[model samples]
Target: MSERYEYVPHHLLRRPVRDIATGVEGELMAVINENVSDAGREHWIELAYIRRTCGREFTTAISNVESVG
Candidate 1:
C-alpha cells in the first residue's frame, strides 16, 4: 500500500526551455536528466542558461614613460 507522488523540481517546471545554439564562448549553465520511469519515476532535473559571449572588449595601452631597470 504505497502510492504518493507530488514533487516537481525541474527549475520550476517551465520557462524558455529551448536554446542550444553551439558557438561556444561563455555563460553556460545546464542540468539535464531524462529517465522515463521503470519503477524509478524520480528523474527530471533540467535547468539550462546559455549565452555565448563575444561582446567585444579590446584595450591597448601605450604611454611614453622612462623607467628601465
Candidate 2:
C-alpha cells in the first residue's frame, strides 16, 4: 500500500528568513516530505534562497530563519 499525506498551504510553510551577513530578507521554502534530515533541511534552505534571489544566492552559513508564516 502507498502512503498519503495532507496538503499544507504554501503560505503556512513559507518562512521569513534573513541573511545574517547581508541582512537581506527572503523566504524559506518548505519541505513536503516528512523524512528530511538536518542536512537536507539546510540544503533546501540554500536552494530556496538561491531560487528566490536568482544570482544573489547567499551562503548557507549566513541564512537564518526568522519566522514561519
Candidate 3:
C-alpha cells in the first residue's frame, strides 16, 4: 500500500517567519513556489511576507518559521 502525505501550502500560513539572512520577521503573505529535487532529498521554497517593523513587503527563502498567533 502506498502511503499518503498531507501537503500544506505556505501561502496559507498565518504565522510569523524570520528571514535567516536579514533577521527580519514578518507574517506570511504568499508562497511563490515549492521545489523538490529529483531524488526527493532536498526541498526549496520561496515565500513573501510583510515586514512587521516598517510595513514593507519582502520575498525570501530559507526562513525560520514561528508559531501562529
lDDT of 1 at 32: 35
Tens digits of per-residue lDDT for model 3, 1-69: 122222347643656767667767787666554554456465545555545657787766635444344
Model 1 over residues 4-64: C-alpha lDDT tens digits?
3333234412222223243233333333333334564544323333333454322111111
Model 1 stretches with alpha carbons more than 4 Å out = 1-23, 29-40, 54-69
What C-alpha lDDT values do all the predictions have?
0.30, 0.40, 0.57
Q: Which candidate is the best by TM-score?
A: 3
Residue 14 in model 1: shift from native, Å?
A: 20
Candidate 2 lDDT (Cα, 0 to 1)? 0.40
Off by over 4 Å in 2: 1-13, 30-59, 62-65
lDDT per residue (tens digit) for residues 5-53 in model 2: 2232343234566655555666655423222235334222222331245
User: How accurate locally is residue 12 in candidate 3, as Cα lDDT from 0 to 100?
Assistant: 37
Question: What TM-score fits each model?
Answer: 0.21, 0.32, 0.48
Arrange candidates, best lDDT first.
3, 2, 1
Model 2: how far residue 49 lies from native, Å = 3.0
Best by lDDT: 3
- CA lDDT of 16 in candidate 1? 26
